[model samples]
Target: MKTKITDFFKLVFPSTYSEVAVFLFFIVCYGILGSYIAIHYRIIFDNRIPWDAYFSFDNKSILMTGGSFERHPLSYYFFNWVREFSLFISGGKMDVNFRLTLAWLSNIIITLNIIQVFKYLKNIIYLPLWLSLLITLFFGVFSTNIILSFTPENFTYTLFLLSLYNYYAAIKLRKEEKIPATALSLAGITIGGLTITNFVKVFIPLIFEKDLFRSWKKFGNALFRVAITMICFIVLYLNRIDFKYQNIFSKTNQQYEKFSNVKSMPTWDMIFSFFFGGNILFPGFIMSDKHNMKGFNFKGLYMDLYSSVIPYFFIAILLILISWSYIKNFKNKWVQIIIISFLIDIVIHCVMRFGLHTSYIYGGHFVFVYPLLLGWLFFTYRTSSKMMSFLTLTVAILCTYLLVNNIFRMLEFFWFMENYYQ
Candidate 1:
């Protein structure tokens, strides 16, 4: 048991002193940022009402340990149990500090994600130290990720789990080994348990594991494992609701339709602005005249096509580079896995238009793909000095722009929250 625990720690943690330093640096940075945001949130918003409904997050319920278990199966239990432990430690006076603790927890997860990106680049993708660090930093400062790091939502946890699973798959792929059924099932349970829809992503790696056409035994084994995972998830979910499963499908679909934005904006604009650009770039803030059930007026930061062409220009360049990289590394299995996983989000939010209006909040689900895909781009051009230098410079510039733009916009958001969100 001791050896197994040590091995698990070794597998999850930074292996080198430099990596550890990087991890700690981000921990402090995000910690301070999350603390600032949480303090402001506690001061600005009425905790009695779900003021965070604008972001589609139930901050009050989440902090108070009553997260929506219907949509997020295990989130309520997870937060409830954590809050119970915290209350016990603090002698039942943890209420004042619970929000801050949750913020720090999110920061820790975000920092771990950074470390995973760094390791995946340095070890599996084999990018240069400088370039890997740049891309990892780029991932850290994404507009949606910055919001998620401090927002106290399930999305941050989903981001961490998905990144961990992807990193595990990448390591296995690098070793030329198939992912074991047990590992896949565990991943399915955790990731799917968090957000039922993401269960599909856990199996995507399996598709790349073997050619199902010829590997009948492997296919059957994978199916059996998937069945087990699904059965376990269903049992847990049903048990949570006392096996009252009659209206589950209708209720879930209705909730999804309530959030859909098929008519809110033009499809092309939604695709370019919110789906692609808004995840990484800040857009103009829009506050609606209407109020929700809690009498809190909803607000959103959105990109407009006519507002400025600058965002679209950046989006076009990124798409072009990603396309170039995809074509160049089409034969690479890891690249394929990353892109396919990303496309899943595109299909769900962009094509299907589910929650397309607030797609930016969903960035945690797929934003990591940006850095990973860019890492593959760096790998593809590593042999060509000129191309490598050009790509490096371009990414550095993009990262710089993103960092400045996102930080400024974040401050703007805070100002808006303070003065207007009321």
Candidate 2:
């Protein structure tokens, strides 16, 4: 048992000193930010109104340990267990300190995501050490990620799991090894359990693994594993809610409409500003009055084309680079996987128009793809010295701009929360 436990620990943690250093650095940075946000949240925000209008999150449900279970079936139990453990540790009292503890834990998860980004770039993508570090830093400073690192929501956990899944799949592909059914099922359960839609991403690796279209045996095996995973998820979900599944569909349908109806802008504007650009760039922050609500108002941070054209400029450059990478590396299997996973988000937010208004908050689901795809650009042009230099220079400028813009915006948000959120 001791040997097995030690092996598992090694499997999960960073093995190299450099990886450990990077992990520690992010943990401390995000930990301090999360603590500051949690302190403000406990003092200012009322527990009645949902926080979605503010930070694009349901902070009331998350803070109260009763998550939106219809959509995230397992999140309620997960947070409840954390709350219980925290209560036990605090001798049955919950206070600001308890919120701070949860925030710090979330910071660890966010840090781990940064580590995974670095690992995937260094090990699987096979980029240079300096380029990988630069891209990882770029991902770390994303406007959405700064908010996610501190917000105690399912999205933070989902980001970590998705990064882990992608990294695992990349390693398997690099090794030319078939992914075991058990591994696939486990990935399905954890990733799908958090957000049901993400379950599709877990199975995408299987498409590249084998010619399921040509082989009935492989197709049947994949179907059986998927069926088993679904059965297990249903059983666990039912058990979690004491078999009260009747109202789930109705509740979810209601929520789907409420969340998806935020089509205030034109479709193209929404796609460019919120869906793609807002995830990375810091947009104008605006607060509006909600007279119907007793003590709070709605807050939004999004791009306003009328206010500035800088966001569009950055978005244009990013899209051009990603398009170039895709066209150049269309034959690369890993590139295909990353693009497919990214397209899933585009379909959901841009095509289906689910939560289009606040699509920036969903950056955790697909923002990592930007850096990964960028890495492929470097990989593709590795032999061309001029192209490599140009790509490096372009990425550096973008990263620097993102870091400065996002950090300034984050500070503005903190000031707003401190003085005005109430």
Candidate 3:
């Protein structure tokens, strides 16, 4: 066992016993910066980290299963039970200020989960891992202005990251890596917990479609997957108590109606922004906006959060080159997994609502689907020129650095009131 632990670090770091050290370094850096900012900015002096939501205080109950029964969805009851007991033990609901503090902590958890989930991708190239982490932090944490914005949205999104990581772990397992079925099961559970989050997950089975017909024998394994999803679905349904979020959907959709192009973006905008956010690219959170007093505004050829960065898109282009070069050379199972998941991510977003702002230009959720595309590229490029590998790495690092810096400045403006400077 000790030997195996030693070997794991060797594989991750290759040269030295630095994998554990570097991982801890990243964690500590994240912890100290995030904790200090959250603590300094929190409204409550005694606000603690690891905050909890007070659902029981709201007396909320979910109605699930098409409203066919009087019982709240099982998920609703489960969470209610959790909330009640948790609050009871923790000394009860906190003030609004403390609640906001908790939201920041929740965002912190979400950020950490994303970093952990993508840790595997680091093995391919260290750059993408850093890039992915910063992207997750920028959009998922600092940019979302999410500390003040709490919802099942944050919880489900965090779970979605877990599910993605677990799915990748399952991939590692197939290669005989030291992973387990727990990752797969956990992935399903995370998906089942949130309706919108589940959308990213429906892509899972599609990856197995080609294998399904050939086996018909793996029916038991497939059934287990189905069973897990069912349990998760039950948990999500019961927790929300209402599977019908059409009203919420409808309200948010107003931005869609108002902002959606009369047609899908012109193929030019679609294809161009697909890779870059157009010519306006720099760093530093658009600091000018902070002093505007009216508020920061984003205006450019393409301003959607996901659509904002174009230079980091070499991975997408690399994937295209690989497909064109070796369509016939692809026999690996994981390659197929990458192909299918990438396509599904694209399809799900294009069909669903993707825009900017609240309806302003809100492609944040949709644009994130880029990672799987990069995964495909990474798999393809592993054997390519070291220069190409380095280029890909450079793009990813720059992409993340810019986004993270941008977000840091945005927070500075909001927190420092920089624009309204007296």
TM-scores across all candidates?
0.91, 0.90, 0.54
How does residue 122 of candidate 1 score in lDDT? 88
Write model 1 residue lDDT over 221-287, tens digit each, in one string. 7788778877877888888778888767777788778877468578888788887888888877665
Error of 3 at 48 (Å): 20
Question: Candidate 2, 357: how far from true, in Å?
Answer: 0.6
Model 1 residue 391 distance off true place after TM-score fit, in angstroms: 0.4
Residue 222's C-alpha lDDT in candidate 1? 71
Per-residue error for 352 in candidate 2, Å, reads 1.2
Candidate 3, residues 60-125: lDDT per residue as tens digits? 122112111221223344344444543554467544333344434444444444443344445432
Provide the clash count, candidate 2. Answer: 0
How would you order the candidates by lDDT, starting with the best? Answer: 2, 1, 3
Candidate 1: residue pairs that collide? none
lDDT of 3: 0.39
Candidate 3: worst 10 consecutive residues by lDDT? 51-60
What does candidate 2 score on TM? 0.90
Per-candidate Cα lDDT values, in order, are 0.76, 0.77, 0.39
The true-versus-predicted C-alpha distance at residue 62 of model 1, in Å, is 3.7
